[model samples]
Target: MISSRGRKIFVAIAGAAVTIVALLCIFPFWMVVIGSLTPENEIYVRGYSLWPQTFSTEAYKLAFEDPGKILRSYLVTVGITGAGTAVSLFIVSMCGYVLQRPDFKSRNFFTMFVFFTVLFNGGLVPWYILMTNYLHLKDNYLALILPMMVNVFYLIIMKNFMRSIPGALIESAKIDGAGEFYIFLRIVLPLAKPALASIGMFIALNYWNDWRNGMLFMQDETMYPLQYYLYRLLSSLDFLKSAAASTIDLGDQVFPSESFKLAMTVVATGPIILLYPFVQKYFVKGITIGAVKG
Candidate 1:
């Protein structure tokens, strides 16, 4: 019922508002990048700016001092993220498909069983003891992948989305002698692309950002993910400053501590940021549809 001019004006205003919000979200990241490039002395004197008066690569140089070690850590993280996301997506989608099957008996019981874990968990001590003492995942890559391979929340979202799939299609496939697995792999999966993309992104981000598993279950420096590797670097910096305050002059200008922190953020986040655009369309569609279903 709105006039054409009103609609145009409304859309223009909405577009402008959205652009402002996007810039607001991006501004902090821009500042961090600028801060990383700005010299330690310049930052101390002039604070953060949209553009730096002087630039330095000292922070990046310090971080990559041991290029071999940094590269190894990156490989480990990339491997973990890739493997974990794929495994998680498969397991989650399979479980979702099975749970949403109309003929499956005791589906509600199994669903509740999965849901219960989300509400409560055995405390950290039990979890650590189970991982290290029982599973013997110490210093193992499975330590990184297994624990996070399935999330109950993702399971729920995927199940809800799969429920929207026409049951008649599954029934017809079965009548045509197509097995459940075939139908799932060929038909259901293709139809659930949006949900798969959405949940896959979440799983990838979880594995990418995870540091606790590395901290707790991994002891070998060679196996440490990029996040834990960066965490170790920061921890060492803190320890050095505290323990060697008098004997060592590890001042801000010497170490470029502030800029070093910003540089680490830039390095750790760069690859994952590149991944967002690929899945963004599917992600938006999937989350909205999945969230509203049950």
Candidate 2:
């Protein structure tokens, strides 16, 4: 048996190791925040520092120059994330529950079909045509929400998580005159909270960070999601800088490009970072749930 002294020593080492790892993970983001406040010239001169050599809010000012657009984009992103996560979660969980049922004879076939899509898809041109020409999703809010509403990876994760639920519990619910939907809602859902929270967070993040869909299907400026809006803004700044440099001799630190990048990083990631702490407990549980289950 290990002695108490050895255990205490081990604990101390483990705590120190965890602290170091945590700092390592957080240090890049901390540098980004500091660099955003540092002047572009100062960044070039001194490089990124824990403390800025010369502080400036120029990057943030540039970012917020058109606060109205940013606010509109924020609203659009939040709506898409909230709606998409909810709809996707419901569909994934229900499908997972249904497929895991032993009595569901077509489960294997259906599971194979879902898994097949993961390995092979019809490619980008067909998908684009389907979304635009066939589905009429161009410039539509459904353009943002519908395409991501059901992720095959999330469905697989949900299925695996649901498979861990004991058949006896479901049978007992049935014996108590519970319908399939009732059993799924009352028993399976509560037990599957961890998986649901994890997958919901994943889906929300996907919607929040998505720019490709916006780039493809959206034309209206008012319809831009936060990520896409910021991307366009940044791209415009870069293009102007390039054009001006080509014609007139604009100085090296003219546009606050580096700091603007850092600032936008801060802006884009702030909400999700704030959100993570609340869902982290469930996320941790979900990752480890059913790990040992056959």
lDDT tens per residue, model 1, 1-294? 579989999999999999999999999989989998999888888987899988898777766654566678789989999999998899899998899888999789999999999889998999889988998889999999999988998898888888889999999999999988999999999999978877887788789899999999888887889898888866787722332224334555475777877887788778767877887876677668656553
Show where candidate 1 strays beyond 4 Å.
1-21, 61-65, 238-253, 292-294
What TM-score does each of the candidates earn? Answer: 0.82, 0.78
Off by over 4 Å in 2: 1-24, 40-50, 61-66, 238-258, 290-294
User: Model 2, range 79-177, lDDT digits (tens) per residue?
Assistant: 999998998899899998898888999999999998898899999999999999999999999999998998887787788889889999999989999
Q: Give the CA lDDT, 0 to 100, for residue 101 in model 2.
A: 89
Q: After the best TM-score superposition of candidate 2, give how far the Cα of residue 26 lies from its true spot, in angstroms.
A: 3.2
